[model samples]
Target: MKKVICFLAVLITFVAAFQLFRQKEGVENESYTINLRHNKSYHDETDELIYKGLLWSFSQVGATLPKKTTARGIEKVTDTLWRIDVSKLGFRPVVLEKWRRIIAAAKNTQEYHLYGSIMLNRFVICSIYASNHYYEMVQAPKTYSEFLHPSVNASSKAEYAVEISSVSKGERLIRMDTTVEAITAQQFIAVEGSGHFSQGNFKEELFELIDMMPNGQLRYLIYSHNGRLVNASPNSYGDAGKPAKCMWCHESYLLDNFMSTPNIKGYLNYEQFVSLNKRNNDKLIKYRKQLSTEINYENKKDHELAEIMYISYMEPSAETLAFEWHLSIEEIRRHLAKLRTHQHHEFPFLGQLYDRHEVDKLAPHKSVPIPKSIREPNDDEPNLLGAN
Candidate 1:
């Protein structure tokens, strides 16, 4: 009976000891997880994990294939900039196969040059215009009528130029604003001579030309000789430097529409495009008038005029400008003093000049969050290449 009791006691003791051991292990695991969650090191760790997976995938795919030269890795150009040669992995059959449908559907095959980048968790395939092709497109049109309208003649010799760029996020390929510049006096003449100075349809043909480009979203900016931003497409105010009225549409509906359909003609009907743009323009004029009334309503003439001028030219955040000019927050605030109108208003004159060191500190965390409705189809899914 005593031996039986002893055996029972030993068994109970063994069970208790095992429970304590497990509890200790669980506590230690919880601590480790909490530390990981709090620390910024997780970002770097995540990036490294993704990078390793990308490298392995590239190796596996590239091994069985031809030993062709391609852009395999990134080279740090500056402290803030890293340039990845896309041509290496960009032309690979494996990579191209993923985008076979998009490539097949593209209208102007000659315009696009494939570019690739391995981002945080996913690899991106960009379809940007080839450098030579872009140059050809931007060349001063042979006929006076072909030049972009509303030209600016500068003292120095100016050239007509256009630049287009795109980047992929999820399933959507977001095209950056196409910029058209007229730098020289002759270029200005060519631009103005292109079309009649009509109110509604001033640069209709030029707009049409831009629309015809592959994946073109009808967003463009025309800059004057002295680097003044003069015109923007979907411009509601018809005034240079004024914000577009269709900003929300561009950010949401248009983006979603293009991603879903991709084919320009099928999604964006010409008649609707013209009608919507014109409607926005009318709304913009009314908006500007209202804005003007608000600005003038305060009745502080000198102070208000100065504030308007500052807003028109500087276009910087109050904090940023203060830092740049070495002014105190109070002093900068006083300089930009105006009647409070909006709850979360940004000071109008905050400019974009940034020191390299400041820019570097901010760049890593700086991401533009795309609306969920316009997000890539599989953006929420775990990256297969990066999965353990």
Candidate 2:
């Protein structure tokens, strides 16, 4: 268990800067937090990464402008190419070509590739190639072990985070420690932020709260106003050491079952497949030669045509567009009102609390972009310390 201690003040990203500044303008300008832990700032917003490949991890994001990878749009990089490069992170003295292949398959895109034990520490490392694109950055995710099982059910986006506040004295920050781990080979990667914070930047006060973790017990957790909360435990991560029991399912849960659930039987791209020959011989054979092939040709074509027509031609008129415009105003207002009413009653979390306010003092809004998480983080040793 990794124990983490944190002390936090009213720390807001660039997102909240203006809201805080409007209250007291003309100051020399307040600095913001930009550490490796999960953070969100208007200046260092997320679309920048989503434009790169964020969906593999984060969900329910609402960037002011849909993140655009290129000048105009997004072109999702295909997963068919499992490209993993270990040198990107500079893993170790001992070479492991297999490890690099494992990470390449796991990078940015949300998916899992199981492998038998290869090393002692199981010190799995995830990659996020942070580059100077648009104006943004993101905390790097390590594995499917951390994905399916998260530390906390983030009210917003679940992120391993460090809440940092700019103080006159210096930089004050806090981190949420612990991540989920798999238990056995037959066991699936259970999701949980199960460890404790082993280290972090803290204030003597808010910092002491996490000192109670048992050495290796703390698991998947997420940062929240109170502190990081465990969203999952060992069982969800995999059949491992402790059978993490759930409070709600306490009647049948046990902590010792963790290590006994048995390693989950996973499939290779080959194992989970029915070779091209089995996908409807005639159809697949034909799809292989068409400009745009199809597995469920009829259904897919029907849906595609309707969807395209509706979006291309039948979409609401401008007046009915959410933004105040001239053409379909009333209809749009009615649709939005209905949407708001429906969302308020059912999807409050997905509703409009996403505020992308601007710092009027800053320059014209510019798009922020990020690079792939497959680059070498140690290409330049002099800048390595600063990179983190």
Candidate 3:
């Protein structure tokens, strides 16, 4: 019985030793698992650290894909768009926007045009663009539209047009008429006196004529028959249209129908000022009252029919005036009325002097410290504040 008792004690001691061994190993395995999980989502060693009590970290995905691969000293990875090879530690990253491959995504932070403005093909480029970049297109840099009053558009380019109907039937004659200088309907002008005339699908012919013409210059006339048109001025007697105040057309000089004005006031050249003062000043001052004089607003009986006026052509002599841009008839009338009122005075109901072609002859608005000494002795100070 004593011997049996001794064996049982030995067995108990062995069982105790085995239990102790298993407990130690289990604790060691559990510690290893905790370490792996803790470090699994970390970047810096501190992220996996026990710290004083808790971990302090910045990145949530401490051990993320791209970053983690790079950290592991990986060699190469190939994808359809990218070939990432980290075996070579010193491989350069792509830094250009136009580069075919993207090595990294760069965060852009900028305001307007200096660095990351992202203004490609803006107004400084073409007169028109996608709606996103439409305002930035290149054209006459004005604050208003010469044609559409109380509204604003860039001046340098004529608006693109696609006629829906025929000019002969008076359905849609004005094909691509956007020039502010074109006051009377889509009447064509004569540059060198040999104005082009054609009909039908004639885009190719027009281009041919353009090729045959000089740089930035083309003279053409529309082929319109008499009495068929309404309130549309024709290039010739054969192209005469109807009358103003006619039942068929809408011809009213309402204020809001105008274009919006710009902030900086456009300037006129000395020559323009002199010419305007000599020839058109008195007549223009009396203009607003006679806006309808240029058109036939009379004859209440026949007013039901459209009346077309033949806006005569009068080119400025090279020696007479130097205009930086082309002038519209509407703008000319405004300036004459505003004369002596101050060139810098902005019209709330109107656009800037920039709408006038004369402004084109002068430099763009700049904060020049204009010397007071240049002021003419008889005239008011040669300068006035155009805008705030």
Candidate 4:
């Protein structure tokens, strides 16, 4: 009788442990708490080696690493989970690829390959190479005044001012680089200025571009004076590449308010400034009107231009789907397992992500309350422009 009782107790304990493990397997591997700042930036040889290795790893799978690839911020949260500061790397326009070694240095090459297989799929790398094709096709002007129409003599400044400036230190001198009727991509450049608007002492160190797409839609692009694309500029408010931070201020087109240029002798009068704004705005409206379907601004706002290009492609986790549809995590898991999906562990603790277009089809019939356990952070969390 004593032996039977001991055996029964052992069997019950084993069953309970198995049940607990199964439950955890159905959910995420682990939970994470993320902080939005990078504790360190790469500076030494070791850092460079790590960074280059990460670049090589990404290149192996034909993935275009994120544009900003210098700052390093990866933290092990628990034994099974890790968290990355996407906010810091993105706004600082710094490298978020510092963690490649963590997977590359796995137990063996096969495990490393497995990690790459899961993370480097088309859906996962979409954000990295979203704008590659378009950017590659663009023969950017050596100078904004070169390829754009109605070229300004680099020194010209528009008679416009705003109460809250975009650039960090100096005033912003607006210039329309294209003609109203130009068939090519319309262009605008905002340069840094100091003192009065008319006698604008423009600096070429920082600049912003508003380039028109072939479809007549507008996309913001940022560049340093050197012509290389930077994440943000001291001359403009838009931080993320493609100026992801600038979208809220510029909803569909230009701002309606046209403040008077400073009382400088050569500056355009308020009336002339207003007229120029109207002309530019009119061009924007005309181009946009050519579209039959409504533009999806939310999608645009959620990602940088590079990521926006591959918006349709994503590897979503159960939590991500649950948060997206305002459904319980369990329901999301139930629906996900029923679909054909290739599961892989995504970076920074996006565990068990599904690689399938069928995930997009699992829409909730009714609004379900999203549990607080699975809330997501804003991809483009606000940071002080040029603070880096």
Candidate 5:
């Protein structure tokens, strides 16, 4: 009788353990379901699922963009799917490639939704939860001047000022750090003045001096302020006595000409500067107009129509466009067909020319003409390092 009692007790304990394990697993699976019903950013069931999937994937890969980390990896799981892996120590390229394939084979964008992740300054990670709607804003190209220039006019003076008045006897200028990993894969880049500066004095003059450096080496100038060469960041080329070290990383990233003379941060804004020059501005003007149109279309009430316009003009991947707008691939394809009816010619799947063609049909006689001498900065131009 005692033996029977012992067996029964053991069985009960085992069942309890199994039940607990099952409950934990269920909770873990549902963990991504954020109750954003009351959140303003919420879209619909599809949008919610996209957000959940993106968040879950990010969590799984431990991708957090924190300043001063070792390496980070982002993989496009699909047009509407993505995963990121961030590490303090290192990363695995094979894992990134795996996610890339997974994303590629995923369902079309209409069936899924799109999301994007951007890592900035090795520290800041910004995720566009609703990428289909807002990816253009996130991915908009900016010139070095536009990237570093202050957003507000009032802040411009103080923002770009270099400290000269309050220099301590041995005030050390901190050398800027450059990592090959940090330079590559970033969508937008810029440079800004650092350290405390006297009121109303700007660093544009200093920037001009740095801009003149050979091989477009702008990173070399961050080592000094007020004629004193400060300490360089650890493991940096500056610390290694390689002032022109930026070339190595930039060249590898296919941005060797990013800092070429014509693309440097001149006295005028990019558009303004291009206007004054004798260069052909047709490409620049068209690119800017397209960006403007995308931004305008993002807020349209008829999301389906808005998406149709976007895909027709932008010609993004069907899956990617669908993911961005919370539609399926089939839905996007159907919209493309409708757009093709309006356009006499067959639309190219991926290119910028689609925007001009679509705009001509949709808004006849209303054109944003490129200025004669205005040229848009190349998309791959070197980004300026903004003031910390």
Candidate 6:
């Protein structure tokens, strides 16, 4: 009888231990999810786990694929690398095949699980893969007159010439167009004339984007002069994509800091540039007032998009974080040590990096009221803050 009792007790203990192990595993899995729903607060982590499975899926996929970029367009540069032409409005079979692998692997993450079907219908049905909705807008008209802005009727073309970029100080012609009916329909294209080329003599390394969504929130995109989506800007150093590089410097949707140099051959004089820009600015603000009924456009500054991308993708070092948050390195380290960490596919290969979702919760609101100052003063930025 005592032997029977002992056997029963052992079985009970084993079952309890098994249950405990499952509970612990569930908690660990939950920590890695990043909830990116638009309406939810940035601080809100308690929403139902919209994304499932381990974050390591992204790393696993990144390991298998060719490095993201090769040459600017669909140039068969190498055996493994092929560039995508954004203007074509469809992924080549080879490019689609590569992104298919990524999408299949990403199916487990929230990026795929929740958004996959939606983006697939929105972008995939249209033929773009591996990118967001704005990728479709690359094929949109490049010039202001081509877009047929209401203001363009008053002038044959709504292009305004500014000085050759005091920001980048590059000898490239810079022209801006901000003339669409509503803020959401607005688009901006700043072309860097043939004065500059990338390492391999790539020409016209300009930035183009449609700046707002239908809801009036900002969206930024970067494309090569050939009208292909590109990760790097010809003017900038690192290969930060889309809004990351663009938003890193812009505090507002439209920056009011285009200085004119009349002596420069192609650009408009100071007075003409200022007067036209103010009129453009006033119209954009009026459009935003129209959108205020449905969207809180002012809640997010353009620079926060940069910060979100930095935290998510960069796995920043202590020094970088210190500068970003206006905190000391030691303090940054302390905060990092407390947060949950993940193995980021891109970097911090030696060890796991802090999870951005958790890190975001620590400072529920913007850590600082003001935007971070530009780290490099003379970087090749032709447009200071451009809105569409």
Best by lDDT: 4
Candidates ranked by TM-score, best first? 6, 4, 5, 1, 2, 3
Q: Per-residue lDDT tens digits of candidate 3, residues 1-388? A: 9999999999999999999999996654332111111111112222212211111000000101233333332211221011212222221222111111111111121212122221111111111111111111111112211212332234532221222222221212111223423222222211111222223332211110000011111111111122111112332322222211111222221111012222221323234324432332233223323432111223222211111000000112121112211245455444444332222232221112222123223323221121111111111121122211
Best by TM-score: 6
* lDDT per residue as tens, model 5, 1-388: 9999999999999999999999985554232211111111122324333333333223212232222432223334444333333322121444333323323322122222222221110111111111111112122212233323243243222111112212212111111112112221111222224332233333321121122111111222222223322222222111221222222222212121112122223233334333422121232233323331111212222322222322332333444344334568687666665453323133333332223234234321221121111011112211121111
Report the C-alpha lDDT of model 4 over 78-121, residue by residue, as the tens digit. Answer: 33233443332222112223222222222123322333221222
User: Could you estimate the TM-score for every candidate?
Assistant: 0.21, 0.16, 0.15, 0.41, 0.26, 0.41
lDDT of 6 by residue, 221-328 (tens): 555655655433544523333343454444335554444433443345556656755665676666666642312334443224323323332344454445444478
Lowest summed lDDT across 10 adjacent residues in model 2 is found at 116-125
Cα lDDT of all candidates, in order? 0.27, 0.22, 0.21, 0.40, 0.27, 0.38
> What are the RMSDs of all candidates, in order?
22.8, 27.1, 31.2, 21.2, 19.2, 18.3
| Ranked candidates, highest lDDT first | 4, 6, 1, 5, 2, 3
Report the candidate with higher lDDT, 4 versus 6: 4
**Which portions of model 6 miss their true places by more than 4 Å?**
1-155, 158-169, 176-186, 196-207, 235-241, 258-266, 292-295, 299-313, 316-388
Query: Lowest-scoring 10 consecutive residues by lDDT in candidate 5?
Result: 119-128
On TM-score, the stronger of 2 and 3 is: 2
Please give the lDDT score at residue 328 for candidate 1. 76
Residue-pair clashes per candidate:
9, 64, 25, 4, 24, 2
lDDT of 3: 0.21
Greater TM-score among 3 and 5 belongs to: 5
Error of 6 at 21 (Å): 37
In candidate 5, which residue ranges exceed 4 Å CA deviation? 33-190, 193-201, 204-257, 260-388
Q: Tell me the deviation in Å of residue 246 in model 5.
A: 16
Off by over 4 Å in 4: 1-168, 177-179, 183-185, 193-202, 235-242, 256-261, 292-388
Cα TM-score of candidate 6: 0.41
In candidate 2, stretches whose alpha carbon ends up further than 4 angstroms from where it belongs are 1-136, 141-378, 381-388
